[model samples]
Target: MQYLVLAVLVGCVALLLAVLALRFGWRLRWLLGWLKGNVLLALLAAAVMLGLAAWDLQNFTEIEPRAATVGTLSFNKVGNQQYEAVLTGPQGNETVRIAGDLWELEVEVLRWHGLPGALGLVDGYRLHRLLGRYLALEQQHDSSANGRELLPNLHSTPPWRDLWAWIDNIEAHRLLEADAFEVRFIPLTDGAQFSLELGPTGLTPVPLNPAATAAMKRFN
Candidate 1:
């Protein structure tokens, strides 16, 4: 809290000083000296900060807590700490999502096409929502409980598989936070260049690009 306050205070002071310098035209000498002396260092510092921020964001994207599921996919420890898929579906809804590595899952292509049945192909996944960026998925290893080793598993299957592929190939904005962020939709890659909010559950899609809504249909 103190650090946040300090940052805010520093920004305000900088702004105030800048305004004063411009208004008075007297701080010109000091400003020039400061710029000449510190400009490169300031830029370097900014670059470092941005780099650290990016690294932190990457870490956040790589890992997520357990007990969380993406859509209907629940992650569980199948065997030997490997991941397993658990499909939970009711009558109308038929869906399959990968477990364990939710945040690691990336969005391939988020088509505005509403899921054909109970499953609607969304622009992003629960994993993408949590991380704030999508793509570069790492397949999870699956091992049988009885000491049998199993091969790696796909992140998602069925209707979501194709969309996941799309997000992988595109770059997009990750919502800062669901409840507080405002999303603008740009459907260049169907969902490649856009920002989206997953809302509270992270499953309830919010602010879907309305322009593409025409392509969307309810499950039939």
Candidate 2:
């Protein structure tokens, strides 16, 4: 929206300049040539602004601070300390075999505060990954519990290329802050089901079944 406004303002200024040059008739040919060049420049500027607006619209959602369910997960035990996990979310259902005592979900969040927040640049988040985790340090290091990628290359993708980092670098005042990463984890019990939520602060897991509730109780 801001980009659109800027584009319109640039076009209006260019039209006004052309009209003024013709009305004054000061070095008519020279001023006309200058206006021609500036007109081309103005067109290029408008095009760039429009492109940015379109990109922003496509990539971002209206930032909401309230908690929202982003996905759900269920587990079935397959072997010792191993489970077949099914995750259903915006991207769809994905199944991965994991070996661990707990399941962890990680997300990347972009937050805007103060003037930017007031201007409607609120918050945006991307699912980072889902991984198996161990409570013990030795098990975490030695166990074969490699996690699965929930969302592919979220940080490196074009147009999204770490937008938070770019904003932090360019903005003199700290109006935006990206959480290095937010994580939520729960015990991985057989037949356990949970709904994952993305809130203003971070990710949270809500148990959905008796198995899940019991697992959480033991974990807590």
Candidate 3:
């Protein structure tokens, strides 16, 4: 991942250098000669970057952040006022899924990737809409616009929403922690079949979006 990110950065710099070289059409020859003076250093940098890129590519292929599949989730009514959800792991998995109660349920993701969606996956915003109930994703950040932090959902910035969005995003991640209603995207095996908290602090669960789960309970 780091190599992927660095390659992207260097690629941009390389592109700019190419543009500038074109702009100095007459000095191109002299610039080429000057570049030769640093050929060894330039070659070393290139080798290092290429090596990093290769390592990053290898890791990307081997690592999967979250196995979105290979697991099943179900919620059931233990009684009239009480609900019980069971999260079980597959043959070779550790993560589990258990929704104690939707009212106190919370789902949060760091919201990386505004990666253009392919396959069945939708872009960040559309995914937000479709899974709104189960997930509560805050708008992404934009540093290039208006010299202020703002919501990534919109193209333009409104100071008020921007400020709220920034503050809320920070608070959301900080306030939620372990023992705050067992978090498992897939199945978690061993230790704490469930996490129980007696205090009010660990009481709330921030489903990535609350709207997506309205139908979850209906499944039972």
In order, candidate lDDTs are 0.34, 0.71, 0.32
Ranking by lDDT: 2, 1, 3
Off by over 4 Å in 3: 1-34, 62-220
- Model 2, position 211, has a per-residue lDDT of 99
lDDT over C-alpha atoms for residue 149 of model 3: 26
Best of the candidates, lDDT: 2
The TM-score measured for candidate 1 stands at 0.21
Off by over 4 Å in 2: 1-63, 144-173
TM-score of each model, in listed order: 0.21, 0.59, 0.21
Residues 1-220 of candidate 2: C-alpha lDDT, one tens digit per residue: 9999999999999999989977888668887799999999999998976675455434433335688888898999999888988887665677778767887776666677788989977677655566777788787766644333232432234544445445546645467676645544578899999898777766778899999999889878
Candidate with the larger lDDT of 1 and 3: 1
> Looking at candidate 1, what is the lDDT of residue 19?
89
**Per-residue accuracy of model 1 over 28-93 as CA lDDT, tens digit each:** 887788888798899898897666544433212211223232233223344432344333322122
- What lDDT score goes with residue 162 in model 2? 43
Per-candidate clash tally: 11, 0, 26
For candidate 3, the per-residue lDDT at 77 reads 47
